[model samples]
Target chain A: MKNIVIGQYIPGKGLFYRMDPRTKIISVITLMIAIFLLGSIPQLLVAFSVCAVMMWVGNIPVKRVIRGMKPLIILLLFTFFFQIFFNKEGKLLLDEVMHVTVVSVLGIVLWTIIWRLLARIGKFKTVLLLAYIMGIFVLFRFLPFGYSFTTFRFAIYEKGIEMSIFVIIRLVIIISLSTVLTLTTKPTDLTQGLESLMRPLKIIGIRSEDFALIISISLRYIPTILDEAFKIMAAQASRGADFAEGKLKDKVKQVISLLVPMFIIAFKRSEDLADAMESRNFVPGKPRTRIHELRFGWTDIGVGVFTLAALALTIVLKVIG
Target chain B: MSYIEVKDLSFSYTGKRMILKDISLSIEKGEWVAILGHNGSGKSTLAKAMVGLLEPNQGTIAYDGVVLTNDTAYDIRKKVGIVFQNPDNQFVGVTVRDDIAFGMENLMVPQKQMLEMIDFYSEKVGMKDFLDKEPSTLSGGQKQRVAIAGILAMQTQVIIFDEATSMLDPYARRDLIEYIQKLNQEGITVIMITHDINEAMYANRLVILKDGTIFSDGDKWSLFKQPEIFENSHLELPFSLKLAAALDDSLPEEKAVKDFLWQSISNT
Candidate 1:
């Protein structure tokens, strides 16, 4: 449960922590743009180095940032595989044609059964399964003797692997930079900074202040609602709701049971919150003052300049290369 | 004039069934009053009506002679604030300091003054050091204390507590009760709506509700003298009060019952 650290603010006192929130927000946006705009390996290396230095200077733990990315591991892997298998623009590293025979089919089946039996005794079952899949691919490439219909060709290209690496690096840098922003800036400041940044949109009647309020409220209540939902889930589980051990349909039914109660609780909470807000004299659209005033300092200016320069360098490198 | 006056107040949620029926009560300045009742007795409904959260179907509530209507609700709100039950639901800010500042911010308090008030009220509630702490990390008692501090920061003259300690543990409830008592001592009018007779005993006056009507209203000692009324209303008596009533012929003074019980227990 504690692993759900995405979008959560970690209190800190690093340089980025003290830098103005507007500066931090702008810098993060700029860095993200630069990362996506870079075309060559050298540009990516530069951007990655900048991210690494930012993580170190911001006092952000690399393990914590990686843990924040844990939920996206599957998606990252999918992107990597998609790029590797589909992008065919470079020199072929390996190409082979093979025939399949009955004996090889039997051998492969026996090997899978043995591996499954061995996997039962393994501590890292997932790692073992991945290894088993890789072994199957190697077996097909080398031995490749099943039936004639099962025989085919396999190829690996340099461009595919390079494209996959680039995509993965882009994802990592974007996720890491955003995580760094959240870790250093408190949620209140983040929202306030966003509100200030979007204040210009108020001329078009966008109500950025209200939007910021909504974001802040949502961020504040996500963990709280999750906690409530977990409690309800536990309560239902105690009453024979088999959320863990159930068929797909049964699990979905259990989910609806949890969701209905959660929605009711959320509605009641919003009504109560409205009352509380009114009692506290909160009238929407009225000018309100904040206790914490945001002020830009020298560090903010320096960071702002550095981010802009980095963005320009990436664009120039993209064009020149 | 009474500090708060509610006359012939009747309210219904759907206009079909009455939640509060022709309830009339008045509270004097600096009075510590507890509205006591069992569940579904409409004590909370009355508290909401008094605070202008729910408009009565018939009758009027006035604060310091100013009538509470649609136009005056905001002004009355500035003078009266409520700390509701379910501390997590009432919290609007991510952090303690922000929560305390929320009310003041809505009132359009200047930043400097808001900071000073947040500091003062948070310290008064003993939550000064926890200003930067997230609300999710705090205990039920601590959250309620922060809620009270938020209300106090508004500088409201009257503070209505709608079962504020019902969800708290014993120790937290005691801590909250002590704070309420201290606030009353400091001349902040307190109207606590609770079903706990033990908690009701801390108040100067008791208003017991039953079936959407006022069943009984009197000073605490006088209310305790008539244990049958408590039994009729389905409210449990505190241990000392129950013992005092059982040994009625011997125990003359209601206030001495607690000390007597302590002495007897020590001797035994």
Candidate 2:
């Protein structure tokens, strides 16, 4: 849970980090639009390069950006597999008759056992995964022995490969653009920026200040609430509640034990917090000053205009294509 | 007139059971008072009532002669600040600096002055270096200090610590006690609410509460004289006070026993 980097802010002093959070937010959104507008390979290359340059200029390490995408890797792989296998269009690239015979089945079982045994060795995980995928395909294609039970045809097309690559690249571009925003801006600043951007909604009687306050408070308490939840789980575990090793019915009961205490603690905390806030003279919906006031600077203006122009150019190129 | 006066105050959450019953107390400017009680003794309710967080069912609380009501509560809050027991719950700001700024912001302090006060008060609480650090990353003691810094930045005349040190370790609690003593010495009226009698001993005046009423209230020495009150409240005397009591009982005179103990210490 700690490794989840979506809202994590890495403190740094750089051009992108110093820009007003609103500008950074706008830039991220603009780039995301540009990424989707991109149609051809060259356009995608341009979008990817822009994100790379933004990461570099922001002093965000390439490794950190990749780390942020770790959880989505499985989803990306699934999408890739689904797109290539399901979509049959354009020129055919591969057509093979794969046999599911006894030897092939035995080979797959042996490969699975070896993969499970070596899975705990973290350094060889990528190599082992690649082998695990390729070895199954190899066994299905070449190893035909005993009595053949089934034969299935495997095929791949040029468009399938092309669309899969495009989809993966597009997702990466969007994720990296947003990752740059979260990594550069503080959580407080992000909420403040959102409030600032949503100020125009005041005409419709929407209170953005209150909304931002809610978000910021939630962000501030997420870790604390999570810590309390884990503590409750531990306490329940000590009292003969097995949250992990339980039947579905028993698991629900165990989870209820955890949830009841958590809800009680959360309510108690909010009550205390309200009292404390009142003691501090915080009147809801009232005007309040801020310590770190956000003001646009030259860099913010420069980035804002640059992103707008880039977005315009992308739209133009899309129309032309 | 007293700095704060609570008269004939009674309160209850459900109205079925009275949490505080006819509680009347007064604190003077620059006085260090400790309100001590065991669990569910209504000590915390009394503190909250004084700060106008909870209204009394029967009587009035006046700060500097102005009565505390719903309308005046917001105004009175500017002069009084409270640090709650749970540090994580009361922390409203994302960073230490913002936490200190929270109160001042609510009172509409200017941005420049707010920054200056954040720096000055954070330094006073020894949290100057941690101004930008998140509250979650901070230790329990550090969060309390940040809370104190926030209250101090608001420049409140009266600061209430409602069992603030209860969640801290012994070392952190002692450090905080020393800091609170220093703050009281510097003329901030300090009202410390705690279940630990030893912690209450640091204050000049001690008020022991039992069963929703003030069981005993007096100067420290006077409360020490009434050992039965401590026993009734399930509070133990500090080791030094206990040793002094033993010596006074065994020896001929209290002064003679103190002199003997001082002489042995000086000889060593």
Candidate 3:
């Protein structure tokens, strides 16, 4: 449970860390738009280099940044595969027919069994498994199993390969850019930034501070609620209620056993919280002062202007193409 | 006028039975009072009533001569603060620093003053280094300290601790009791609501509640002299007193017994 990193913020003293959270949020959004607007390889390289430099200058650990991307591996691969298979423009690179015969089938089965065993030993590293799978297919082509049971065509084109790489890089850049925003800004500051951004909604009679408070309170209670949920689960388990080992209908019943108590606890907690808030002199919709005031310095203005410029340039690039 | 005055206080919640009934109490400035009771004894309700968190069905609570009504409750809250039982439920800020600043912010204190108060009170609570720490990462005790820090930053004249240490471990409870004692020593009025006779021992005055009424109100010595009061409230006598009673059947070596009594009670 402690390993959840969706809202993780690492304290640091760097350019991005020092920038105003509002500025960082606006800049990250603009940069992401620019990244998606990138069309040619040169434009992609420029955007990639800028993100690399930002990461380097921000002093963010590269290992942690890569770890943050682990959850995206499947989505990235899906995008890569979809582009490669669906795209058919540009010159043909390779086209071949492969046979599925007795010996070839034997080799394929043997390769799969060996690969699975080795993958387990290797901790199932994605790149290693992929390479091993590709190597076996290439090796089987040389086995010369001419008594064919079936055959399938395998082809690759220039545009397909180029499109896959471009799209994958775009996705990576967008992810890393947003990661930089969340990693540098503390959760409090993030919500405060959101409040500042939503200030315009005041014209419509919406109080931004209330919205920010709701978000922050939700973030604060998520872990505490989860902790209670786990305790409730353990208590139910002690009473012969098996949540993990149960039939479909039984699982639903067990889940309700957990949910009912949780809902009660949550409602009671809210009541207590309201009482506490009132005791602390908190009045809703009342003006309040903050200890950590967000000040827009010259550097913030500079960053804001730079991001705007980048967004404009991307717009121009898109128009030209 | 007394520092805090609650007169003829009777309260119930939404057509429910009376939780507190016709309770009148007055606390002097700089006094430490313990309102002791068992689980449904209405001591907690009395605490909330005193702070204007709950309006009485038929009575008036006044602080520094101003009676608390709907219009003046907000103003009175500025002078009195409460540290509730559940630490997680009371925490309004994401971090310790912000939590400490919460009360001051509500009063629209200047940013500069709020910063200074956060620093001073957080240090007073010994949570200076945990200013950036989130509430979830902190222990139940640490969260309570942050809560106290928030109240202290408000600079309230009277602090009502509503069983503040009930949920904490023994060590944490002891630490918090010492801190509260120090606060009382510094001229702040303290009203601690608890069922622990041992905790009530630290207060200069003890008010026992039973069945939604004041059973006894006096010093600990008087309360101890009346053994029935303890039994009626379901509060346990300190082990030393029970031991001394078993040994000789009469109070002996008055000073020695008192010293030993406090020592044993604190140890637990």
* Best candidate, DockQ: 3
Q: Considering just chain B, what TM-score does every model have? A: 0.92, 0.92, 0.92
Candidate 2 C-alpha lDDT tens digits along B121-166: 9889999999877777899999999999999888888999999999
Please give, for residues B1-268, the per-residue lDDT of candidate 3 as tens digits: 7978888889999757988888988889999999999999998888888777877899889899999998998898888888999999999887898888888999999999898888898899899999988787888889999998898888788889999999999999999999998999999999999988788889989999988889889987777767777876798887776765555434467657666765776454
C-alpha lDDT values of all predictions: 0.85, 0.87, 0.85
Docking class of 2: medium
Q: Residue-wise lDDT of candidate 3 within A1-321, one digit each (tens)?
A: 543444768877888877888899888888887888879877998888888987997798877778778889888888887877678889888787776778887887888888788778767578766766586667556565657787776677899999999988898888888888888898879999989999999999999999998998888888889989999998878887787786899998888888999999999999999999988888999889887899888878888887888889989999999
Estimated TM-score per prediction? 0.86, 0.87, 0.87
lDDT of 3 at A66: 81
**Residue-by-residue lDDT tens digits, candidate 2, A1-321:** 333332768878888877999888888898788878889766787778877887787688788788878778777887787778888999999999999998899989999998988997766665687779889999999988888999999999988898888889999988887888888888889989999999999999999999988998888788888888988888877888787796899988888888898999999999988988889988898999988799999999899888999889999998999
lDDT score at residue A38, model 2, on the 0-100 scale:
86
Model 2 misplacement above 4 A: A1-6, A100-110, A124-127, A143-152, A201-206, A222-263, B222-255, B258-268
Error of 1 at A84 (Å): 4.3
Worst 10 residues of 3 chain A by lDDT: A1-10
Instruction: Using lDDT, give the best candidate's number.
Output: 2
Answer with 1 or 3, whichever has the higher TM-score.
3
Query: Can you tell me which runs of candidate 3 are displaced by over 4 Å?
Result: A1-6, A96-124, A128-155, A233-259, A319-321, B14-16, B242-268
Which residue segments of model 1 deviate by more than 4 Å? A1-10, A66-84, A90-93, A98-134, A150-152, A156-162, A203-205, A222-230, A233-243, A319-321, B222-268
